[model samples]
Target: MTEEARPESPDIPAAEFEDSDLLRPIVESGVGFRVTSSLLLLVLLTGWVIFGRQLLYGLGVTGLNQPVAWGFYIVNFVFFIGISHAGTLISAILRLSQAEWRRPITRMAEVITVVVLAIGAFHPVLDLGRPDRALNIFTAGRLQSPLLWDVSSISAYFMASTVYLYIPMIPDIAILRDRGVWPHWFYTFLAWGWEGTPRQHAVLERAVSILMVLVIPIAVSVHTVISYIFAMTLQPGWHSTIFGPYFVVGAIFSGIAALMMVMIVLRRVFHLERYLKQVHFDYLSRLLLIMSLLWFYFTFSEYLTAFFGNEPSEMRVFFYKVSGPYAPFFWAMVVTNFLIPVLILSFRRTRTIPGIFIASLSVVIGMWLERLNIVVPSLANPRLPLPTGYYIPGLVEWVMFAGGIATFILGFVIFARFFPLISVWEIEEGRRLSVAETTERLEGYLPDPLPSAPGQPVSEGG
Candidate 1:
């Protein structure tokens, strides 16, 4: 393998490794470098115009109305939040399970979780009919309201996830500082003068380990609290005990799909196939498939119970989803979320890179539909038996949606431009640990490494 394609061995000092096998290509690739920059500026300008419109005309310009106070903004909010769950859960699970292949992918995933969470969590304020009265959420905020639960839990999730991303990033930031390419003062400030000394490394490791354990529960709580916003409401379609786990599972499902899609794009754009190998895709595909099944299970249970129980309100909402105006989206969600991914991923041959990409794309679409299903159908079938009005997002909402996507691309692209998108140092550590672990496993199955006398030369196996 080429030097740029191979990770440094553990024996090599991290300080001497100027470029990592995983991240060098990304830094040097120049892919999406200019396109993302221009797009970011465009998105920013467009977003400004949209917000200006909203400011001038007020929330009346948007589709939100009495009773159905949330619309595309809220749907996008949930979609983004679900996608944010991708990083924390994947990183924590991989760390907890000690997955060797997670080394290169973890940082990107964690960064996505942090950034998307910030974007998603803010969306509610944007949805407020009278946004200037937003502080009413605080001054008159009832702790009893599910909205308050959402506020508390999402804030906690954001803080926890951000810390999770930052803690691991400090060591890498220190590496950048040592290289003298980053803004010296800025990186120096962020790095906190990490010397990579044994003592500092030990403390960093302990802190990261503790945070990893802490973050999982916080992540779960965030999604659960979001679901509670619907469930705790006397809403017909949402009042169920199943919502907490259902939302959590759906968040994780969508999160992994987003992660896989990001990894695919980054791998091709930055030519990271060497570090983020086919094996990584293979493993992640299996994970995505597993999540697909779990999502299906939850969805089935949720809808089935509602349908079978036949409560007037719940049945009205459920049938609206099944056969009403939203039926196209609802069925499309099933096809995309379950059928496409499950079929393609279940077969080993079809689990190749391109196939996996298609499956990931399907999952992304499906999960977005899932969010829409959760948001729209219930609103369409209110218990009051009033005429169901359609919701078409205003131009401002559309612009903001596009802007949100552009911002995500811009942030990740800029990050890739400056820092190694992959964790160079972690890849090296993984190489050593993976080799050691594999060797141990092999020894259990095969002949042991040949022993040598005290003064004799050792065999290659040794």
Candidate 2:
């Protein structure tokens, strides 16, 4: 074996470290974990209590009136779904690009996609409050409605993302199974007889590659269809050809921000400093910055087109956004979504972990407001002009919203307790194979050394 074949870089974490360290979370999370988890679960239960109240009192418990039938629930539906885009979409893109750094981050991203997606999927049903009737769409399902398209697409995405999240996790689960972790039977079942043989490894890689290619379009379509829920309508502000791309971009933008926040929290909580290094943060921050710019451009083009068109209905909604009751929310959205992120993430001096967290927090809040603005204004200031109705989400909606967020956190906590947030096998694989693979690929790019200048110098070490 050549001397160079040995893994040399000190910074390259050892595969054995996976056994010693990464498995710790699965084996034992400290007492603080229990306390915090109990708290999150308690908070999550409160939302159910509020939901029960809504059931008792009826939809009147919400602020939904004639014109503004949507409220915090629908806005949060869009917001949470947007956050869902961060996971599988980014992870798939990075993996397809053959990015080595993606190994540590992809699992978390995919998990976020899966967990938040499940949470988001229930939002529309929550809005309806009749989970039983949600199935009527299937019983009396009409292919004509855009709402039907949303149901089909989101359901497909959820199933696809869950499978994607699971496929890569099998090897790790097998490792835990072999180690005889407490839930040996569960991991044993999940591992699916994976012995990490050469054939198994190859099959795993092929499956991941195919899924990565497929997931990007599915992720994009999920948010695009969600946008169609509004865009398909002939409402004043909601109707636009750009809404599809706009929603897709906004989804990814918010998704990246949400991922950053998750990354930060997981790193701090799990003490994963070795796995999730500062370089990961820097790479992810660059993505966050790019998405921020794209979001700003979309928002600009959207409003600019409206301002120039000056249609009475569009203008009423647009002007209301700029200077009416919603003005504060609109400008705040701009500042949080664009200004704060741009200012913090643009410069390395302030792009610390905390900085990214603050920026991510801003983007999350801003994106919620952005969704609210998109949903409310056009409905409140209807083109038909039947006494503009304003929406203020009542106590029930606020409790439910808090519960939804708590559910996300609690889900992550529960997931971490059960599994390693990082893809330990993928990291080891990269350390082992990526060097040789990258060198071979780079060699293919060189022009065969120019035939040694026609043999003028056939020097041995030239």
Candidate 3:
């Protein structure tokens, strides 16, 4: 029988435990990596060309016009930022809850949040017609402007998430240092002279714990402030007290879906079936299902309020979503976001890898549609219709979208090549923790170890 088929025994070396699950996937995702990297580079070069054109010729190259100022770029901005929320939520929230399974997964989720947040945060600058005047937002920055709120909250969230990703990474960096494969100076620089001493470990643990506790609210606030940017405007479809929670929930919903997709791709690419087991997929599927329901509830409430209140601006935007040019996208969002995920994830068999993959893919696409719906239709149906605004995305927008996604892939690809994508130290830590947690749970279930044969005096400890 294969090693996997053999029953696990105590004889298994503890050293074998270290983050092998994470390494397995990285090892397996082979040569095609170079191809993906090359493609990403080409895309990045193209994006630069487009960006240069925009910079030189101005925002005139894009379909963006007056009133409908924000278009695909902002949609993607919100979409990507929402995706960033998932990593910290998974890594920090689950870590705080003492979920033993979090060890192998937290690193990937945390990296996703940091990288995607970087991409998302840059988008507003891209949206600015006068990016050269960008510092003016800060120099003459109005504390009252929702735009300024976005700049502040996004910057804070980025800093917090980056620190969160770096803290746990120190141990792994120490591992790499020990491996002795480096530019000497480069690894030395990043390793921060880590010795992994007991004091160092203790300090690192304390830092991570504090950051995890701190990041949740910051993550929530970042998205809330993002929603406030829209809601603070009295514009149709943008104004709603519920917008804050709605954006946060939607951010998490999309973030989790994006996380599932990343995990799936990495698993397939890296061949980490052992570490990223079916159990992880199953749990993720259930979470996705829950988020789907939550999203549906929020979407329903938001729309129902708009429909029933008969407010002209809100109703105009709502009907435009349902029956206007955006009708197909809106309904498609319903099907993909709600119907598909709910049906597939609800079934046990459908919680498997392929099923969850379908659900996650659908959710990602649907969430993008939702962002587009929120942005465009409202702009299209202005309070004072200037010939019913039309947003025809030009080449610049497409290049930017492609660049953002390419950058995401590029970052992961580079990470996979340089360092083990999985947290080696954490995985080992997890196995020990998992066994301990399981034993504790099982002890609770079992009859007390027969209070040691009267005065036979059971050895106090196992």
Candidate 4:
């Protein structure tokens, strides 16, 4: 029998074949992919079913109550949104700085931003109980409400992040198009007629440069606005001036952790060890450590100020966190967010891949706990003379939380099935251009050769 002949892709030069491994996941699927995708889909479906129950039964199905009106949903919303920062902000910064090691990692980072942002955005609807009530924010919303600000900022962020994610993907899409990958129309359309011409490359670079600069401020403002939701309030723990920067720091901290974990998992799953090397993890781990320290500093400053001020209302919430019912979670946040990460990430002996993974996992958990502490404690201990509130997340909330996670995983899985998780074009671009660019940049950083005693020849090394 004659073997099938593949169509020739004239646009793809021989160099495009250099990193065929990056395209392996798109072309092949094994049992692991099937099982993982199936399980994730099941969890997502279950979450939707539980959400339907909540919709029918009302917000009473959840742990929300009079004073502690925000529970798991809001906490998860903030946490997930915080995780979204792992992508666009970090990727944009790396791209802007022209970090050569960013080639294989930026795509995954940007993907995290877009996927997690979608899940996080949907959470407000879940929190509303009556999902229809969310529309009222657009129609009858007041500028005075921080909730309105959240909607505006998050919406802007979502749009910017989506565009930022897509623009960089066009060349890859065009490659897939030329290769005649399945769903030809999809790749062809999204490729936006990319032809790999010199002008096309120049245009893409300029667009990415402009977008990277623009995305930084938008990404920073997103979490800051989310912080304002709590900080603008007169409530004790929520009313701190530091909350804006605190929230941003925590978001970046959690984001870096989440990004690292995703990179590690994908590296193992796709056998991408060649692309995601030890240096990538090492650099990222250092950033995570720095953020961990910053997180601790903010946490310390916020609490120290509260401790020193000694206002009766502030003390109520402060003790409620440090010694009251929330003490366990609060302390756990310190250990996971600060101590574990710092200890594991500080020493070279413990900063291996596995250790970094553990540190990243700890930071993720700690960040969630941090969000919980921020949201529940202040509301639980109101300034008014009310009973101390307690919250145990209901089954629906737990399932929805699981579903949010499942959704994030499934989004990555599906994206991998269609597109390369590591940016193929960027990796190729780095190989083709970054070495020389970096050399030039380094030369710029060095001192110029001396005049060499009027007429003496300068050393070639100089």
Candidate 4 lDDT at 83 equals 99
Best by TM-score: 4
Per-residue error at 235 for model 2, in Å?
0.7
Arranged by lDDT with the best first, the candidates are 4, 2, 3, 1
TM-score, every prediction? 0.89, 0.94, 0.90, 0.95
Q: State which candidate, 3 or 4, has the greater lDDT.
A: 4
Model 1 whole-model lDDT (C-alpha atoms): 0.82
- Model 2: residues >4 Å from true position, as ranges? 1-19, 452-462
Question: Candidate 3 local accuracy as lDDT?
Answer: 0.84
Compare candidates 1 and 2 on lDDT and give the better one: 2
Q: List the residue pairs that clash in candidate 2.
A: none
> For each predicted model, how many residue pairs clash, with residues at least 3 apart or on different chains?
0, 0, 6, 0
Q: Write the per-residue lDDT of candidate 3 for residues 59-178, one digit (tens) a residue.
A: 889999977788988999999999999899778988998777776688889889988999999998888878899999878999999888888888988999999988888766666555
Q: Listing every candidate in turn, what is its Cα RMSD in Å to the true structure after a full C-alpha superposition?
A: 6.2, 3.9, 6.1, 4.8
- Candidate 3: Cα lDDT at 123: 91
Worst 10 residues of 2 by lDDT: 5-14
lDDT (tens digit, per residue) of candidate 2 on 390-433: 98889888888888899899889888888889987777778777
The lDDT of each candidate is 0.82, 0.87, 0.84, 0.91
Residues 1-462 of candidate 4: C-alpha lDDT, one tens digit per residue: 111121332335544487878888886767878999999999999999999999898999998998899999999999999999999999999988878899999999999999999999999999985697778887889989888888888998899989999998998888888888888999999999997766777788899898999999999999999999999888898998899999999999999999999999999888999999989999999999999989999999999999999999999999999999999999999999999999999999999999999999999999999999999999888777889998989999999999999999999999999999988878877776679888999999998868769777676562
For residue 109, model 4's alpha carbon misses the true position, in angstroms, by: 0.1
TM-score of 3: 0.90
Q: What is the lDDT of residue 258 in candidate 1?
A: 87
